[model samples]
Target: MITILNSDKNEVQKLGDLKPGDRAEIIGFEKAPVDFENFLHRLYEVGFLQGSILEVLQEAPYSRDPISIRIKEATYALRRAEANLIQVKLCE
Candidate 1:
């Protein structure tokens, strides 16, 4: 699991747990699949870097598997499993 302490002692949480309208700062990544390098590369390419602020835009009402998040002026849909790999600190 990824562990990065933030100011104010807020517990770092999985990005998948964020609901619509919630904002957070990317902190780190948890252990990922075998092709972790490739996965990290893709996430970085899409702006999922440490310290980047993102806002939850939407999610599938029933399954909540695919979540839409806005980062750096762009929005992208990510699976809950994929999002679970990202650690974040909630923004007040």
Candidate 2:
């Protein structure tokens, strides 16, 4: 579970819950439920760094597994399982 503080309110959700066109910023990670114990380092390497603002661009409608997100000046597809590790603050 990810806890997001937005506009003085708290919104708790996992990265997999975001839909296309939603805007959010990377907060950190949730250690226990992630793919593995030490997946944080790999996530950071793939631009999941803190304070980065990301925009959801698209998602596989049928499967909803691989979602496309835009971060910085690049784009990447991330699986729902992989995305769950990221904690984000949704913009209102």
Candidate 3:
């Protein structure tokens, strides 16, 4: 289900910014305009929900539009535009 959320203010990066093998925790969603809220809701339902741990498994060799992310035992492929809506804290 979708819910209201606010992104973290510090150490947070958009998922599209992650390089392969990078790790991060799902902090929340970037604030969206009322019209764009539905898009964030869809992303949330796709396992980008708060507190989920994720890793950048791979990036497309070419345009890098669709990136692969692993959360627990499942892998999710997301478009860069969709990944940009999710906020994450990069891990060292």
Q: Best candidate, TM-score-wise?
A: 1
Candidate 2 ranges with C-alpha deviation above 4 Å = 1-9, 32-39
Error of 2 at 40 (Å): 3.6
lDDT for each residue of candidate 2 in 1-92, tens digit (9 for 90 to 100): 99675553247556767889988888777775544656667667768788888888999989987999998778888887778878888866
Error of 2 at 6 (Å): 8.6
Better of 2 and 3 by TM-score: 2
How displaced is residue 34 in candidate 2, in Å? 9.0
Inter-residue clash pairs, candidate 2: none
Could you estimate the TM-score for every candidate? 0.83, 0.75, 0.73
The per-candidate count of clashes, in order, stands at 0, 0, 0
Off by over 4 Å in 3: 1-10, 33-39
RMSD in Å for all candidates: 6.6, 6.2, 9.3
Better of 1 and 2 by TM-score: 1
Consecutive 10-residue window with the lowest summed lDDT within model 1: 3-12
Residue-level lDDT tens digits of model 1 in 20-42 = 98899999999888877787788
- Name the top lDDT candidate: 1
